[model samples]
Structures are given as C-alpha cells and as structure tokens.
Target: MRWGEIIRRLVLIPPTLFGVAVIVFVLLRVVPGDPIAMMIPPGATPADIDRLRAFYGLDQPIPQQFVTWLGQALSGNFGRSISLHQRVFELVLARLPATLELALLATLIAVVLGVFAALIGVQLRGRRAEWIVDGGVGVLLAIPDFLWALILLLLFGVLIPWLPISGRIDPQIDIGFHSSFYLIESLLTGRFDVANALLHHMMLPALALALPFSALLARILKTSLAEAEDQDYAQIARARGFSRPEILLREVFPNALIPTVALGGVQITLLLGGTVLVERIFSYEGIGNMAIDAVINRDFPLIQGLILTFAALFIALNLAIDLVVTLLDPRLRHG
Candidate 1:
C-alpha cells in the first residue's frame, strides 16, 4: 500500500471512533430507562437517588458526562457496570476471547467452503453441478444464524446426541484461569484432551454461524471467478498452454479473491454482532452473551463499551482488508 493510503486510514480512525462514541453516548442516555432508577433500592428516598446519581456521575449535564467518559475511555477506563459491578474494560476483555474463538472458527469454515464451492461452480459452468452449488448456496443464505443454531442444536444435540448441547467444555476439565482464551490456555497447558474436546464442542455452533456467510461468499466468489476467467490475462495463460487448474490456481483465484476479501470484512462485523443470539443459544460465555445480559439488566457503561469495541474492531478489519487487497492487486497499488 502507498503512504497516502496508510496515512488516510490512520487519519480516519479518530473521527470514526469519535462518531461512534457520540452516537453510543447520546442515544443510550436518550433512551427511556434511567440507570440510577434501576440501580437504586426499591422505595429509596429522593436524597438516596440523587446521591447515587452523583456517585455515578449521571447527575452531570449530558455534554459534561460525555466529555468525562470520553477522557476516561481514552485512558482505558470505561467505568463500572451498574449491573455486574465490574469495570467495563475488564468485563469485556474477560469474555472477548470466547467470541474471538467462535468468530475465527466460523470464518475459517466459511472461507474454505465458500472458495471451494465457488471454484467448483466456476469450473462446472452451466452444468448441473454449478446449478446444484447455486441452489445450495441459496438455501443456506435463506436461513438466519439463530435459526441455524436452533436447528443444529435439535439435530446434533437432541436427535443424534453426538455433541454436547451447551457450554464451551465439559465441567470435568479444569481449564484454569491461566489464560483468558480457552483454546490458547488448553494448548499452553499441554492438555490435548481438553483441546480436542473444545474443538468437538465448538463444531456445531461454528457451523451454524458459518453456513450463511459461506453461502454469501460462495455467490460472490463464483461471480468474480467467472469474470476473472474471462479476463485477457487468463486467456493469454490458456494460449500459453496452461491447463485449466494451473490457470485458475495461478491467475484467476487471486483476482477473484479481492472482492471476497472486501465482503469478508463486512461479514466480520455481521458475525461479531450476530454472535449474541448464537452465543445465547449455545450457552457460550462470550462478550455477545455479556452484551445481551447487560441489556436485560440495564448496564449503560457495559453496553457503550461493547458497542464501541465492536465498532472499532469492524473499522479496523475493513482497513486491514483494504490494505490487503491493495497489496495483492497491482492495479490497486498505482491508483
């Protein structure tokens, strides 16, 4: 990537984050529920209410509150959750890894399946094989993640009983608090049994989360691959006596992947946000589940922190994808 692009991405980060902060701060406050009212004991006196409000800084003017929160946020302080009574930063960090693990596993499944399916569609062209792939993609895309989660739970958890119905692992295993991330902790502790068990437990939930995204990616990839195959360079490669597989592997795949990379960035945000329902269904202890619980309990600080973190991650992923695409495609490097 050029220096201009690098500088541009860096410059946009602050304004984008500030916009997110402003929106979360203002809209959350504007909502009907009062955190102080929710936090205080039932039948508490006006004096008690005022004291609690002042304690949490909710009595201040909205602008001053925003300024105070923003300053603390910049210094890595997001305030304590009214519901959980824990620092918002620490609360999120604790559960973030579970969400990351789920998201990464789902993305891996999606990309692998999507790319291969697209490749098959491109190769088969107008044949029944291509039609089959297209139809399958359509069916998968038609279903939402939560529905998939329920269906998978019923099938694998109830009907077949092959996988554990809920939770990240069997309670018998003491995975310990050595690392916040379960997978990493398992590996570091040399607990292969726990690692295997974790992967097995994760499969159904990951597949549930991944299938729709894979379908969307497959559709995009098939179209892009077909277009790439028709390009002059692909034709030139064919003229040079390269086989179909060689042409696809060497020439078509890279060009076809550019749009997929961009779409994948968008999918990252969707997958992360959608994890709330999926996590709740699977009984997975992740930030998405935390967010859901926070909402139910009226935790404003926790909600703001989760939204800001997710927004920041989404923006950062798009930036990274843009840089990757620019680096991969020579045409993008110049313009």
Candidate 2:
C-alpha cells in the first residue's frame, strides 16, 4: 500500500510541476512590471527596449512565451535572471544550500525545544507549572516568526551584540569551501572553527524561525502525551510496576511521538516558507533572501524557478512524511 501510494505521488509530480509553472508564469506576466524596462538605462531608446524584450523572449505572446519557457524548463533550463544576469538554475542552486542549512538548523532547534517542553508538560500535568508552560507556549504562538526575527534582532543584535546578526558566516574567516554546505563541509574537513563561526551567525535567525513552530509542536505533543498516558498500554505498563519515567520512556513517549513526527514534517515546509522574510531580516545569503530580491526586481525567470523549486520540495516532503508515518505506525504498515 505504501509503495503504491509513493508510486502514485511520483506519477503526479510532473503535472504538479506543470500546474505550478503555468500559474507562476501567467501571474508574473499579468503583474504590471516590464523586465526589459527594469534592465534598460533611462535614456535607452524604444528600439533598445524592443531588442531586450526580443532577446529575453518577452516580445512573444503570453501563450507562446509560456510554451517556450515550459519547454526550456522541462529540459532544466530555467533561463537567466533579469537583474542578476545569471542563469536562474545556477543562482537558485548557489543559494539553496544556505536556505537548506538554515532550515535544518531551525528544525533541530524546534524539535529539541518542543520535545523538552512537551516532556516538562507531561511531568507537571495539572500543576501550577503546567499553566506557566501553557502560558509561555501561548505567547510564543501568538507572535509570527518574522516579528520574532525583529525582536531577536533588536535584543541580540543591538543591545547585547553577543551574536552576529547578519550573513551565513564571517567575511573575515576566509575559509575555502568545496561546496555551498559550509557547516557540513567545515565539519567534514575538521574545520571546527569555521563550523562554530557559522553556527554563531545562524543561531539567532534560526531560533527566531524556530520559536513559533516549537510552541506549536509542544502543544500537539503535550496533548498526544496526555492521551497516550491514559491508554490501555500505559495502564498495563503501570500495573507491571513500571515507574512513570520508565513508562514514558519505554512506552508512552514512542506512541505520542508518532503524531508529533508527522506534524513536524508539515511544519518544516512552513518553516521553509517563513525563511523568506526571516532571511531577509537577518541578511542571510539564502534562496529566501534571493527570492525577495527576485520579487523586488521583477526577475521573472528567477521568481518562477524559486516558486517551482519550493513547490517540488513541498510535495517531496509531504510524500516523505507519509512514508515515515507509515513506517512508525504498525497498523499502517500492516493494514
């Protein structure tokens, strides 16, 4: 059943991408912005503008433009950016790792904080401490990630100035990177100092991006844990002389985590989306920051490429989450 589902999703990928491509292509054209005008100098002639439009294939009718772009994109050629004057694929690829690293770090922080909070909630169930925990979670949830970004910027970047507020790594480090995955490459090559510097720069932004999601995970996991504790398996464990901690660790926690893990996967995609604004605030050199640049400059090719990439990632993540949930739940696997 799982394999069949996976295959079905895989079959849907092409059409999914096609739909995303068509929508973005049309919407970008519909918006009141001329890529050629943005590219040309103020004194440029109408002839120059026409030539530039012809060069970028913007002179074609909308349907023809879409058809041409679709063919090129199908062959993995996403065209060049108007503002950046670089291939869209190359630009997106260059920045993708930075966004991915930030997302992964944020996910790690969120998961740890969430799990710890949930455990605390379980331990302090029905007590005054529980109210405190719930209140804190509520506050965290009330604020969106971007506002958290600004607050963290003001707090850590201005007054205290303990951490680097912008960029992925210090410009002074001058370390040679083999690939764009600076943190992983640094650690693999035993460059602990480089890795440490990267983390120092990333920590605040990642934390800002993490807090809301962590609060959400905490709420969900706490509920799941409370329910799991009242289940027959938990009762049986208690009757078998298991301590609260032992039952939680050995039985109830795993059951509770199944749902939390599934939800975490969905939140990760949202976290990725949130990075667009958060990255811009922190001046992080990720695709999200690039995305903002693309939008502002009306870089049609880059915008379409980035949105398509995001859509593909969302679909893949959803499929992977389904597989993971199935594997974790015996009923799903066996049924």
Please, what is the whole-model Cα lDDT of each candidate in the order they appear?
0.88, 0.92
List the pairs of residues colliding in candidate 1. Answer: none
Top candidate when judged by lDDT against the true structure? 2
Poorly placed runs, candidate 1 (over 4 Å): none
Candidate 2 local Cα displacement, residue 286, angstroms: 0.4
Best of the candidates, TM-score: 2
Candidate 1 lDDT over residue span 1-335, tens digit each:
78887898899899998998899889988988887777788889999998888878999999999999999999999999988898999999988998899898999999899888899888999787878889999999999999999999999999999988688888998776677788877878788888898888888889988999999999999999999999999999999999998999899998888888877668878987888999999988888888888888778899999988888878887788888888877888987
Model 1 RMSD, rounded to 1 decimal:
1.9
Candidate 2 per-residue lDDT over residues 1-335, each given as its tens digit: 36787798899999999998988999999989887777799899989888889888999999999999988987989998999999999999989999999999998999999989999988899898999999999999999999999999999999999999999888889978879999989989999999999999999989999999999999999999999999999999999999998988899999998899888779889999999999999999999999999999899999999999899889988888888889899999988
Cα TM-score of candidate 1:
0.93
Candidate 1 global lDDT: 0.88
Clashing pairs in 2: none
**How much is 28 displaced in model 1, in angstroms?**
1.3
